[model samples]
Target: MTAFKPALILESVDEIPESAYIWHWKTEHHFPFHKHNKGQLTYVEGGAAFLYTRDKTYFLPARHYMWVPPGVEHYFQHRYPANYVRTIYFFTDEDDTSDPFYTRTGIYPVNNLLLEMILYTSKWDGNVLPGTKGYRFVKAIKNILPDISEQPLPITLPTTENTRLKPVLKFIQENLAESLTLESVGQEFNYSERTLIRLFRSTMDISFFQYLKLARMIRAMGYLLETDKTISEIAWDTGYNSVSAFSNTFYKLVGKRPSDFQ
Candidate 1:
């Protein structure tokens, strides 16, 4: 097989033929914020990816896919090297406007049936024009998505641009394994605990502990997808002393145990 070239795809996606398009590639590069004129569905394999919007970040784990509606401003980040990504872009039908699914952006886990269907299209790529068998097959994939992908993964993190809070959030992310509390963080940043609490509430609409928990979970997710660490090691790295506590909290937030997630 030929090596994947991201520059070629990035330059040609806009000028492709009518109806639909498919591009499969292995990439470690991140895309800058951009939008498409048509709806897009991207399936991920081998490694994980993160989608960033203006105010939120969405996680797309392995064996999962993300739907980006037409004209939604966003970008994709690959934390690990050489992630396999299969993407298909389609023109929206007039009837699809009535359905809420085609209008919203989300990330969903892919079942075996959907996985097989997507991989079967590896024989073809780029500009699946109307009246061809490839176009019909891909259109069917688009039609069945709403029924199979009703629930999106709930691993989104709220983002902020406030100058005062950006450094605090960065500190929490860099020191997930360290003991973090409002008082400790305030001392590091030279603010009172009460003032820090109010800052979190006003700027991010979330508590300090709440944000810390979420940041830890997100880090744990990256470890689960991209590393060979044991559950106990991952728990320790994510600031948990006991495996049970980490497993329980992981399940509660991510709907799966660390072992199952791997």
Candidate 2:
């Protein structure tokens, strides 16, 4: 049998200087499905990228990172032009008894300190080992990471090959300001209500209705967090007929008021 070869591999843990490392992305590139023995925090200092695993595909824009647990098979694509991609990997062998969040994987918000530390550590060529530092940098990181905060953007990303939901997702994205329904989509796509429901459940692991709501919610989130748009404006822009309806739906799905993300 042929051995499984990874597209990228770091030397063994003992050979490395720290618990994490970084690399830059030059031009657009795609890394085929692969697995890492250690958990990874994938962040980019510039541009954006997307990650696809067995269960879901994640869009990681700038100022964000996607966490990947150890031994999970996944693939990634870097954006076009030269981009600065920074990845920090934690050795799977590190037994952190208190780190509860290490096992969960998703896209998350990045604070200034976390961003700075990632950038700072990426500069370290490991001149000094763990204990020789003024303060144990790697040790500090292990503790700091768990509390960085997790902002779930629960959006339905399109699949690579089987994209029954692609046009539906695209419609939702482009027409976020308008009302929608699976029945309406079925009519447009020439699919029956029964087929649409089945395909959506199979393709996205969610109902067509749920995915539509999530798609709206994701766009609403971006406007809420990234812009100065009024909640009422965002409400209408995100397909809600009323601000109250939008707020309720946003709160229900996001577990926070739309204003909170601002």
Which candidate gets the maximum TM-score versus the true structure?
1
Measured over all alpha carbons after superposition, the RMSD of each candidate to the real structure, in angstroms, is: 2.3, 6.1
Top-scoring candidate (lDDT): 1
**Cand. 1 Cα-lDDT:** 0.84
By summed lDDT, which 10 consecutive residues of candidate 2 come out lowest?
1-10
After superposing candidate 1 on the true structure, give the runs of residues whose Cα lies further than 4 Å from its correct spot: 1-11, 16-18
Off by over 4 Å in 2: 1-19, 24-34, 44-51, 58-64, 74-85, 96-100, 109-116, 125-136, 147-163
Scored by Cα lDDT, where does model 2 land? 0.66
Give model 1's TM-score versus the native structure.
Answer: 0.89
Q: Which ten residues in a row have the lowest lDDT in candidate 1?
A: 1-10
User: Could you tell me the lDDT of residue 6 within candidate 1?
Assistant: 68
Model 1: per-residue lDDT, tens digit, 157-193?
8878888888998899899998899989999999899
